[model samples]
Target: MESLSTKSQLDMARNVHDMGSINKMREAIASGDETVLQEAAQQFEAIFVQMMLKSMRKAQDALADENSPFNSQQVKFYRDMHDQQLATDLTSGGGLGLADVIVKQLGQTEDSYTPASVIRSDGDLSSLNRNRVYNVAEAQDIALSSQSIRSPSAQKD
Candidate 1:
């Protein structure tokens, strides 16, 4: 079973999707303060976008460096995923553009990209709670194995 820490991180990442809705939910559950909810929502959205951009940049840099062992094939996967992530960001209430750098580095065109399938396909939050956001921290064989890109490259961080 995945640990609670991992689950919590995944929840945070998934929650990054609907900042407004999340704030409303939090406010409704707390005391129905729309202003507090709005502020909280903005904060969450900002933090989420910041984190995503940072992660995307780091991943793109790591992948692009030939010595990093990310390799061309792995870079391709990460690139595609990053592109999808960028598309999703366009629909997000908070506008961020970190994915643009990653997409450019990957040599992807705007037309070739697609939006986030997970968010688009999934329904409401309570009904659509996702599994853990997979990360290298949880991988047991990263150092033990030869694969440099051990986890799914499609993942942001």
Candidate 2:
């Protein structure tokens, strides 16, 4: 494997989204190519970490200043680049251990393994907890009830 620059590595990581690139990664793992397997696993892990970071950022949108000059497209681009680099660095530093798990599982099998059955659960909300499924009214009621339960002395402060 030739040494690739950060940009090249990022490009390769982006290519992992393509079916052909995924198939090639599977083939490399099946062949027990340690270098390729490690690279692919790390890239996959970085993607996962990046997704997590994106989700966290999205969740923080409510707290963001809407009128800030730093909220422009250029800032967003830089933030995304920062996130990508952070994901890569985290994965290289033994991240959430996803890469290790992926490498271990792939290394254990001589051939690529496929599930015998596929179960689809699209649009299913039955698994959600009551709190997660609560309507706005119900949530407000809960908040009010909780506030009512607070001690008068504590509330005064």
Candidate 3:
């Protein structure tokens, strides 16, 4: 029974067609694999697209006539399959760039990355003073003092 559940979880994570499943993220992270991470991110993006399409279909169905042939169960099943494939194709073709963003955020090395729970659990939060900024003026002054500058890189001509 336990093995069956575990196998299902693995299948959910590995199957690109199962856009709604995201149960194996912990496994992917534990494996410490970039390709796995990339695949997971892509799958996440595909899931997002699928959800959007599902919602759009629901909205479209709201005004749909029940007596219409287009509203048949077989038609809906085929339509859903089409949407799933469309989502997968869109993700593979660079998608909405959500996968790239996910990869960028989570692909950091252990040394450079610290989980939020660890920081709070350590109880070394003397740095986060409550009265650090009492007023808007003080906050503005502090923000101005340590303003971060960003340099935009122009593409090569």
Candidate 4:
């Protein structure tokens, strides 16, 4: 039973690690926050493009000799960095337009919204309820009082 539980826990951990970014993107899209959703979509597109680049590199024949001075671990690391930067630049500069399509399909266009700065003034808690705002001291006092009320020792005293 213990071994089964441990195996299940390991599987859960691996699934969480693999789906972390995807979960974040889903959350952003579901949050109704246009800016965050758009940014997440763009980043996802960038990652997709980077994966494509890596695959393409793997498919290509190595033109450089193994004994060449330019062929080293550092060179490979720098090449990966270059590929990452290229992916970022391509996405930012409207590379494949995948992000744009995603944003459009999600119906989060810039035309349908106003900036928050223009809508709300400073010190605006009008939308928030009273229960949402409380001091830490007040919370601690409430907790202490609740514990005292619930304790059998307090009742006996």
Model 1 C-alpha lDDT per residue in residues 1-157, reported as the tens digit of each score: 3334433433354433454555445644465332333334444455566566667766767757676655566876776566545544442444554333333544445777666884485664452243232344446456657456456764456
61 in model 4: Cα distance from truth in Å? 5.0
User: Is 3 or 4 the stronger prediction by TM-score?
Assistant: 3
lDDT score, candidate 2, position 103: 84
lDDT values for all models? 0.50, 0.71, 0.74, 0.64
**Model 2 C-alpha lDDT per residue in residues 109-128, reported as the tens digit of each score:** 54666554434445555645
Better candidate by TM-score, 2 or 3: 3
Q: Write the per-residue lDDT of candidate 4 for residues 82-101, one digit (tens) a residue.
A: 88767766776576989888
Better candidate number, 1 or 4, judged by TM-score = 4
How well does model 3 score by local distance difference test?
0.74
On lDDT, the leading prediction is 3
Model 4 TM-score is 0.45
Clashes of each: 0, 0, 0, 0
Give a tens-digit lDDT track for model 3, residues 46-78. Answer: 889999999999999999999999999999999
**TM-score on alpha carbons, each prediction:** 0.23, 0.51, 0.56, 0.45
- List CA RMSD, all candidates: 24.1, 12.0, 13.2, 19.3
Candidate order (TM-score): 3, 2, 4, 1
